[model samples]
Target: MTAFDGIGGAYAENLPVIMISGSPNTNDAGAFHLLHHTLGTHDFKYQIEMARKVTCAAVAIDRASDAPRLIDHAIRSALLASKPAYIEIPTNLAAAPCAPPGPISAVLAPERSDPDSLAAAIDVAVSFLGKKLKPMLLAGSKLRAAKAEKAFLELAEATGYAVAVMPGSKSFFPEQHPQYIGVYWGDVSTKAANNLVDWSDGLLCAGTVFTDYSTVGWTADPKGARIFTADMDHISVTGHDFSRVLLADFLSGLAQKIKYNDATMVEYSRFRPNPTLQPAAEPEAALRRGEVARQVQSTLTPNSTLFVETGDSWFNGVQMDLPDGARFEIEMQWGHIGWSVPSCFGYAVGAPNRKTIVMVGDGSFQVTVQEVSQMVRLHLPILIILMNNHGYTIEVEIHDGAYNNIKNWDYAALIETFNAGEGHGKGYRANNGRELADAIAKAAANTRGPTLIECTLDRDDCSKELMSWGHWVGAANARPAAAI
Candidate 1:
């Protein structure tokens, strides 16, 4: 049940995943025997039915004759749509005789754009790109879903336009590239990057979704500005919508026609004459969010995967620079509080060679803290940076309530119980910058299993972006009903 929402999130983030689970016995569908896993009922179809709301395909393998077709169809649908698919196997079907399985080679062939639509989208985009002040390019999360991040990068390089990635699309383009600007998340965007992008006469947004979350509570103005958007299956230009013009095809086509221009980058350099880095808090000073971030930033190595939990962690983690070959994972689309704890474990399990770093708030940490024991049992060397603030700070920023508070936990000490003298998991408390640095060093040294460093934080401490975002989002949510 918990996995359902996260799987649904993949669809909104424009990613693909396959979820498989077993349903109740189908033979006694109407016999209400109050099965243990059936939510106090005998309905065997609720699992598939609920999945249907979020997955591109949801199917059951009831008969051996239907297994191969149903499974193949579910996979193909998921891949083609870049969304999740669910497969349910009944308990009775587990031991049923079935034919030998064959290889599953469902191919997602490159889809071509409609010729006329492609030509028009390219022409419309070049009108913006070919300007004396070349338009800026804003890459969105869908670039990965469309499998067009490479194409998007090629387009940026060929056109010489400055590129800024959406917060959700972190690390899609090499952040170290000369043509790259910082994130373009409206008011939360880096000042120089925000100015450069906003001042442009025209902008081309590729594979972007402009929900309230992405727009920072409808305060972002990309769509309101002079811009054209290219999505997975269509391109919308000024007063024109071109359907069936796939994002990848449009990028390839536009790259062939657009002229090179570096005006945007030139302006960016002048606006951000000297990149600023505030000095870290004195080593013995109490740990603030930014100071903890600074310490974690120092620990990022090449090819490490970062898992940022929802809440203020989103704001902090997104600001960190990911080394080349590093990846960023966040469940921002769903905004599920506890998504990171287990997701980090899963990522570490799948890519054992890469270090997995997770930053989570105290409230969210408690939601799925049990996953830490599994990581210890598997002896996975993952780093968990926990902010022990005693309550849900993000919620308080948005809408304060009694429910926002949570009992404080001794998070660092709790990890020792998981370690149980046999496991290699290590836990430490960091009350200051020096303690944080020391804990990280020890985590790096402990190569056998996971490590938890619970950094103490003031109850009200949070990123400025979160406060600003929460203010706007709260206003939007509280807006009174419009007169019909």
Candidate 2:
């Protein structure tokens, strides 16, 4: 495959991309002529050489002892560069004698915040927070990656700021928390949600990437307002230029310096849920799907790990009421459509004690349904919930009737076709609310092996909240410059 294709594209999106390549040693290059694609190739650093053009940094390691240091350096370089990095490890060196383990140290520690600079930044943030009628806290994946969830939540609570979690940080905060304003991306972000972002006078962004999807391509501007950004690396007031750069280790230090007051808390306490005013008579099909989501959520155990596929299935699935100990996972960075099924398999293998539940649309499930065979082979007790709406529902919403549909498949029968019917796994189907409840119950009770619950839903029975958001976004985009 060409560079920038396959997983390489992940790096192109300004996200961290690390490539590890196995190559022959420099001295053995002569004998490993066949490994080279072209003749007269003396240097055996093809991978590293090629990677240098595409990656921010590239290095070749000939000794096993240098692998850890090289890897750490590559990762640090990639994060700082905000681009991809590559490392080529010679096959011979991989098996070489290990070096003596030294005292471990953080390769990339947070830069110390200057006392004066820190005071100025905190003063600006505190002044805005104190003055703003409504302030918000937007938590991003960086907080989760840095294990700063408690600090984030504490800050949000202390400031009485309504918290809106970025899509990638779904489980970073408890959804049931009164201060939580719901997900800030995908289908969950409605006009009301956008309004909340619009209404805020100040935004305190903690470890978040204020990217397109998260802000709906800057539709929700934090302009005319102060923006306080805190991360391991840098902070920007308006996110235009770098205002201050701090090492990650200084988050606790920064948090301690900022004082929380009752006035900030008072404004946040006044925040209320702005639910969509639905019609008295909801469509029969929409009602059915809602009930199905409700049923599945109710049946899930506290320790369940839910993996939601990208699309309408994800939109509907996250609306479900998750239990206290339940955790959710999705490929937010890549937004890969078929990630759920295979990712669920990996999660099941990695976490054997927890029950892994995968919620996927029929369209996305077909992408990597073959992994179900592997699941059966491993006897991993995973549950797959197929929302069989018979098409790519989200795409249809974005581009109505524009070849977004897909051919139907016998979703439940696929499990039987794989012979995972009894001891290994079982398959079940549901069409309505009652049937969905039964199917989910059966799947939960089947402790021996994996289970596939295919819920046949009407393609028209999509999420109203999602539809409204899409319509608003489209309308906003279509409006003329001055009018908007």
**lDDT (Cα, tens digit) per residue for candidate 2, span 1-484:** 2443423444533446787777766567766564544344666655566677777778888777787777778878776655688888776776677765444455565434566665666655565567766677777777755557776766666665677777667777777676676776644563234456555667777777754444544555454436767765555565332344452433454456555543433544455455543222232343256666666666677788888887766666556555667887766566667778877887788889998988888888888888898888788878888888878876676567747788898878778777634446788887666566667778778776789988888887777855755565555556677854
Local accuracy of candidate 1 as per-residue lDDT tens digits, 1-484: 9788778777776667999998777666766667776677656677789999999899988786788778788888888789999998888887787775566555445556799988988887877556546578998888889888889988999888899988888888887788888888877885457788778887888888777777878888675547888899998866788899888889988888888888888878887746657578999988899998888888887878888898999898888877888888877677889889988998898899998999999999988889999999999999999998889988999999999999988888898899898999999999999999999999999998999999999988999998998898888789999999
Largest lDDT belongs to which candidate? Answer: 1
Candidates in order: C-alpha RMSD to true structure: 2.1, 5.1
- lDDT scores for all predictions? 0.85, 0.67
Best by TM-score: 1
After superposition, candidate 1 runs with Cα above 4 Å error: 30-34, 39-42, 98-103, 107-116
Q: How many backbone clashes does candidate 2 have?
A: 3
TM per candidate: 0.94, 0.78
Instruction: Give the Cα RMSD of candidate 2.
Output: 5.1
